[model samples]
Target: MIIEIKIPTPGESITEVELGKWLVDDGSIVSKNEEVAEIESDKATLTLVAPETGKISFKVEEGVTVAVGELACTIDTDAAGEVALDPPVAAQPKAEPETIKTEASTEKTSSADQRRIKTTAVAREIMEEHHLSVDDIIQGLQRIGKKEVEAVINQPTSTQKMESAPKNLFSRDESREKMSMLRRKLSQRLVAVKNETAMLTTFNEVDMSPIMEIRKQFQNKFIEKHGLKLGFMSFFTKAVATAMQFHPAINSMIDGEEILTPQFVDVGIAVQTPKGLMVPIVRNAESKSIPAIELEIKELAEKARSKKISVEELTGGTFTITNGGTFGSLLSTPIINPPQSAILGMHNIVDRPMAVDGQVVIRPMMYLALSYDHRIIDGKDSVGFLVKVKSLLEKPQLLLTDGKLPEELLLEL
Candidate 1:
């Protein structure tokens, strides 16, 4: 019996997906539930597995967009697996292992085809200096260069000796790859955000000494208490959540001349995955504890990287936080994630000289950049929101120490 493999609906918003690549060749036997092809959707990449043990045949070519539930391939469940082995030859008897040569090539040195080469200007000059014929270098190169000319000049000009040795052209290896559907989607969205939004970025630096000191002191205890490693993400998420309440514009979205604001803050974390950049939201992030926030972030990031995160989790973000610091980037202007008016960019921390009580001292410092939609959020609010985040991060004990935010930190919205 032949089993039909159909595309499963990845999501409601995703009606179609591109067949990224076929992992197995046509008529190759595969086991049940074995991954046979990869499906690329707008949100992420998904695997298409063999439905039953069988020989598989592709019904659709790669990179073709097909609607949900459309036929992708077919598997022949009745077919047995084929085992291919090389043809055997008679063995040489009484031969020692080291004295025996395995085989001789059918295409010998004299049988090789000479390659045609295009000579460049520099090659011509070198060829003139070496007083060699064009054919001298043609057999060894596709494009003539000084090296090829030099090679030709060093070889013997005897026709008999030249005929005995067939020279091979130096070939450059290259590969061509088609872009994945997710990458195409990423490109389109990034360009759309750049053209459609009146984006502006504000920059500031924070002394990370306080946060680092706290982490160094209580990191073991914090992990023992929470069962999770103390990370800067939780701190930033908390800070951004607290900061968003004070500056509502940073959390608001512009929808066709209407400003849409959410009462709760849903922070989108930009997670880098093999698929591409994915922003998974932690819903109601404003209310979650630091430990809860960290765990959810860990789960979402792992899911995103594994391409198991749902489309729902990737959507509806109120604000985004992207840390280029993970890649050791000192500074970068992150573009705003659309619908969400602002995105905070975090950078690498470095020990730098800072002023403390009118005295210069070395402190751990990190640069923060907030890119916002200028059409909706004014410069003042953007700067104010970033400042609030900076202060919270610098003095995190005010919020993260006991899970209680001091009343003074809350700006009445």
Candidate 2:
């Protein structure tokens, strides 16, 4: 039976999405839940899975926008998987791979198709100065004329190449593809996050000595007991939760005339996935233990990478913490995740000289940035929230003594 695969409603407010690309080829047999195509929405790129194991056929081309509930493709569960491998029988001439040689060899090569060389202005000028046609460069590079070959001809060259005027980077006869739909959408959201919000950033530096000491003291024991490494996220998460208690505005969102304050803290941990940036929520973070927090983080991170995180996982987060330090970013003002009043940005830790006692000593330190909506959260509240988090991280023993145990925090664990 022919099964119609429809485009799913990406989200509540999002009604249409671009069919980015097809992963499986037409007539290929696909398994149940195997990703067949990718859909790009305003929020995130979602992979459409095969609903049933079957032979697949493409109904819509890539880079086309389809509305929600429209037929995207078809699956024939009963039809046997077969693909036509033979070329057309009536083909005039057989062009073998070895027979495909450039006519530029001992012959004046020209195309009536009007191929203009598209390259950097400098490269174009140099190409012109050399009196070199794109065909000359392609033959020199041992590549057939293609658009990318054109780009290679257009690539920036050193003075030596300009002087020589006889070399090419690659074949200049290939065409290039447009940017993926997901990339375009991602760029749009990032710009929107910057312009649409009353964005303001505050910075603070925290001494990592206390947490380093704690990790050195208990990391082995903690890892042995829980099968998960003790990490800084738990401490940071707990600290943010504690701070939210004293300064609730950091966890509040501005809705025109009304300020909506979340009673419980659903901290969104920003996990960089192969798909894109996914912020999975750590629900009721105020009550979660260190081990429980770490485990949940690990699970969410795995889900994020595998693209198994549900739409629900990405929703209703009161606050967000993004550690750009993982990617070696020294400092960044992370835009507030919309509807969330604030976000915490963590940076790389490095040993730096500081005046501790009477002498300058090297201590590990990290810069923290808190970006907030200036509309709802006052500067005092935002700064105070970050200060509270910094204090808890710098003196984790206080948290260890006062924080809830695993049994109290996570019921499953």
Candidate 3:
């Protein structure tokens, strides 16, 4: 029996996809539900798995664009169990012991030692004139003396330095490749964002000392309890969610000239994968605890990188957070993810002297940038939102009270 494998639809509107690569050799035996190829869509990359255990044959070549539901491959279930097995151990050849030749080994060692010893120009000439080798000269030296030690110290270090050679050598080769569907769509959306929205960026800095201290102090306990290490992204995601309460405008988006603001916060964490940058949404981020947020981010990021994430996991985010700090970026103005009003950029942390009270003290600090659509988000709101996020990150305890002091929340202020 032969089973056909077709290109699976990545989303409702996607009609075609590019065949990215073949994971298995043609005619190779594959198990049921085993991933055999990768399919690339505008939004995400998905794998095509075998419908049943069989020998698979490709119907479409890799890197070719094919319509959704098109036949990608076929599996011959009748060919199962035809794979040849390895020979028996008793029928294989036996091992033989290696014998060393002492004379040849000693000669090889002597030649190697002679090559390592540096000789002066005049010394080489006299050796050649006398038909002598470095080993012979060394064997002739019966006693070690101060003069011999000084001669050894004065010898040239490297033979390459003694020879002159041109240092200007480089390659001018170039190559081109067809862009994947994901990258092309990313280009279009990035251009659309620049042309369609009145995007503006606001910047602020956060003292990372507090968060670092908290992680260092409780990281072991947190990992023991959660089975995952606490990271800076969860803190930033939680802080953004809490800060959105103080400034809802940053979380709102424009829909056909009407500003549509949702009551819930679904923060998209931008994950960079080999295929491209994929932002997987963490739904209802406002209601999730730090450990919960960390675990979900880890799972989603792993799935995205492995090309196992679904299209539903990548959509419906109200806001986005991208940490350029992971790439050593000191600062960057992140572009807003379309349909979402804003994106927050986190950058590398550096220890710098800062003015605190009446004295200057060194603090670990990170710059934060919030890029939002100016059409719906006012300058005051963007700036205020970033400041609020910074404050929450600096005073992480305030994140528990929605970016407010515990006392203020207790007093109903």
- What TM-score does candidate 3 get on C-alpha atoms? 0.81
Question: On residues 16-129, what C-alpha lDDT tens digit does candidate 2 reach at each position?
Answer: 888988976687666667788888776567788988867789999999988999999999987533422121334312332122245675433322111322222233345446
Local accuracy of candidate 3 as per-residue lDDT tens digits, 1-413: 98988888898888999999997768666667777899999999989888787778999998999998899999998887564222233632343322324765632443334344544333444544555454555544422223344455456557855675756579787899889999999999999999999988989999999999999999999999999999999999999999889999988998886889999999999999999999999999999999999999999999999999999999899999999999999999999999998999999999999999989999999999999999999999999999898889889999877787888888999
TM-score of 2: 0.71
Better of 1 and 2 by TM-score: 1
User: Each model's TM-score?
Assistant: 0.73, 0.71, 0.81
Error of 2 at 278 (Å): 2.7
**lDDT of candidates 1 onward, in order:** 0.80, 0.76, 0.84
Ranking by lDDT: 3, 1, 2
Candidate that would win on TM-score: 3
C-alpha positional error of residue 127 in candidate 2 after TM-score superposition, expressed in Å: 42
Of 1 and 3, the candidate ranking higher by TM-score: 3
Higher-TM-score candidate of 2 and 3: 3
Off by over 4 Å in 2: 81-186, 400-413
Instruction: Please estimate how well model 3 matches the true structure, expressed as its whole-model Cα lDDT.
Output: 0.84
Candidates sorted by TM-score, best first: 3, 1, 2
